[model samples]
Target: MDGLHSQQNVDLEEFRRRVQQGNDPHGPVRETLSRLGDRWTPLILMILRTGIMRYTQLLKEINSMADSPVSQRILTLKLRACERDGFIQRTVIPTVPPQVEYGLTDLGQAMVQELNRLIGWLEVHEVQINACRAEYDAH
Candidate 1:
């Protein structure tokens, strides 16, 4: 097999070993993906890649750019989840009223590179994916 297929085979083997439907429902990879798989998580994580942003800035970015806009309550939940997962950092500055900001942690920064590649792959394959969906629906 070519290198790409060979690597994918190796990855598949690794995944099989790590994740069992019954025994290991929440393996490291699976669990991590579960956290990141949420629509808001990746959006929040990626938005922080640019640098530290206040809550309103993050909210604005997601609402303006993402297909599904988030309400303040939902945004709070997603932000808390990301922070709990160690993928993002939250800072509360003490001032007249106090200010809150968010940014990526080291782990989150590393993941952004992979996220970018994943986005690129999706862009490349989107047409084929849509075509497959259309064909599948037609049949």
Candidate 2:
């Protein structure tokens, strides 16, 4: 079993080296990450994870965060990008006053489980992460 695992690891390393050397076996994955890794995308995704929300609500919620208050221009750009990437759906309500709401698409909802897992991991390891940061700063 250990020998099999070692062989698997070697194969993975070789694959990674080949990919790094411009033999991209996974070009689509790289492209997707490149498209989605903008500054505001993750924050928008995180906020929408709660549920569907109106545009103003999202803006206010983002603004309330001290560490990352997304500018209106950047938020507009990110939302448009997400829409183009099929990560989210935007709806406009027809009424005396128009209302706009945003929610995750099917593909975006698929990410929630993984996102939750990541958040759980962060919560579990937060103490260690903070300790490491403090130790590094003190050095």
The candidate that wins on TM-score is 1
**True-structure lDDT of candidate 1:** 0.87
TM-scores for all candidates: the values are 0.81, 0.71
lDDT for each residue of candidate 1 in 1-139, tens digit (9 for 90 to 100): 5999999999998887766642555555665687678878888888899999999999999999888789999999988877876888999999978999999999889989899999999999999999999999998
Determine the C-alpha RMSD for candidate 1 after optimal superposition of all C-alphas. Answer: 3.8
Distance (Å) between predicted and true CA of 65, model 2?
Answer: 2.7
Off by over 4 Å in 1: 1-13, 21-28
Alpha-carbon shift of residue 1 in model 1 (angstroms): 12
| Per-residue lDDT value at 47 in model 2 | 88
> Candidate 2, residues 23-133: lDDT per residue as tens digits?
454465564576556566777888898889999899998888638687778888888877877788999999779999999988877766666788799999999999999
